[model samples]
Target: MRAIQITEFGGPEVLRVVDLPEPVAQPGQLLVDVAAAGVNYADTHAVEDSYLSKSTLPMVPGGEVVGRTAEGRRVVALTDGGGYAQRALAWEAMAHEVPEEITDGQALALVVQGLTAWHLLRTCARIAPGESVVVHAAAGGTGSLAVQLAKQFGVGRVIATASTKEKRELALELGADVAIEAAPDGAGLKEQLIEANDGNKVDAVLEMTGGPVFDASLAALAPFGRLVTYGMASREEPTAVTAAGLMGRSRAVVGFWLMHCVTRPGMYREPMAELFAMTADGRLKPQVGGVYPLTEAARAHTDLRARRTFGKLLLDPSR
Candidate 1:
């Protein structure tokens, strides 16, 4: 089997293609013939050993895959790791059969990015219809889905922020009521966010970019508003928050991690099925920005970290 291996912690340069033996499945695990692997922001972090959890050395760095079992059932599986290969292992419980109506890339997108978007809106933000919402990085994978889901859930106004003009346009096409530039270093950001909401603070925010973006998002929240922090793509720390400030405004700063939801039954499965149904019916569109061959894993990471791509990125192991 051909896989992308990282023997040392660094940047995308560390992801090297190597020929390795096939992995055998253990008890309660399934061996999958890899078709496509989902590349996520977390994978970039994992490769550099800077993720929420420590990454081991000499490892393959993919978390979600859409592939087949020995019995020929097409499924989307969440691997502990090692998804960037021609063959990989998955826990039987974690694998969900892919619907015939969904493409391999679509199924793979719904695993990590899809679930995170769903939980961030439904669980963490507790979003209510007719409320104003903000989705940062609106042209990216989770952001694109979050934008659509917010509208589906009946949000009054959806404000989307992206770094490029084309990205902002894509967000509007996905149903955002307003699209604005995500200025670097929070330059005029809070004002732009407030201006997008018709001179009013927003009701909820789905924030991932940390540092200045996070600070601006927090400042733009309305009274009793909730801001859900999921990822720090900027790799910069945000300003610290004190309980006093939150209490004064009756605001909340909640944190969410998809790994926590994966441990609890029904949390992941129910929403994933809903996402699949939505995608099948054409209500939700999973944007596959780019697909790279298995050997070009380094390029994929480079594009992702550099914000040179949009939507969900995939790796075709068969290539």
Candidate 2:
């Protein structure tokens, strides 16, 4: 089996393609022939040894894949690791049969980004209809889905922020009520959001970028507004939150991690089912940005980290 392995923690250059023995499925696991693998920020964090969970040296890096099982069932599975290979192991319970209408790449996107977007609004933030919301990085994988889903959930106003004009345009095309350029240092970001919402503070915010963006999002929240922080994509140190700062506005801040949801069976199952139904009915769509051969994993990471691409990046192991 061919796999991308990281022998040491470093940059995308450290991700090297190598031949490895195929893995066997343990009890309660299924061996899958990998067709497509999803490349995510979490994989980059693993390579840099910056994630909450550290990776062991000389390990194959990937967590989501769409492939066929020994029974020839087309399915999307969440792997513990080793998704960057021709073969990988998926827990039987975590595997979901892919619908005939969903492509392999779209299936791979749903496992991570799609589900995260669903939980961010439905569970973490408990968003309500008629509330105004802001989606950061609104043209990226999760953000793109978040913008569309926010509208489906009946948000009165959806404001999207992106670094580039093209990305902001993409967000608008995905159903955002308004799109604005994200400030480099997040200066005046709160004011921009307020102005986009017709001078009303947002009722909810989906924030991943930390540093000034995080602080500004907190400030932009209306009284009793909720902010869900999922990732620190900026790679900057997290800003400390003082209780007093939140108390005065009656604001709330919460954190979400997909890992926590996957470990709890009840948490991920229903939402995943909902996402698949939406995708099948055309209510939701996963945008695939780039498809790279397994050997070009390094280039995929380079483009993603540079923020030069939008939507989900996929690796075709069969190539």
* lDDT of candidate 1 over 1-319, digit per residue (tens): 8999999999999999999999999999999999999999999999888899999988999999988899999999999999999999999889998999999989877888889999999999999889999999999999999999999999999999998999999999999999998786998888999999999999999999899988888888899999999998889989857788789888899999999998797888899999999999999999999999999999999999889899999999888
Model 2's alpha-carbon lDDT is: 0.90
Candidate achieving the largest TM-score: 1
190: Cα error in model 2, Å: 1.2
Q: What is the lDDT of residue 206 in candidate 2?
A: 97
Q: Per-residue lDDT for 1-319 in model 2, tens only?
A: 8899989999899999899988988999999998899999888889988887888988899998998999999989898889999999999988999988889878888889999998999988999999999999998889999999999999899999988989989999999999999785788998999999999999999998888899989999999999999998888755647899889999999999998888786777788888889989999878998899999999999998888889999998877
TM-score of 1: 0.99
Worst 10 residues of 2 by lDDT: 233-242
Off by over 4 Å in 2: none
**What shift in Å separates residue 312 of candidate 2 from its native position after superposition?**
1.1
TM-score, predicted candidate 2 vs. hidden true structure? 0.98
TM-score against truth, every candidate: 0.99, 0.98
Tell me, by lDDT, which candidate is best: 1
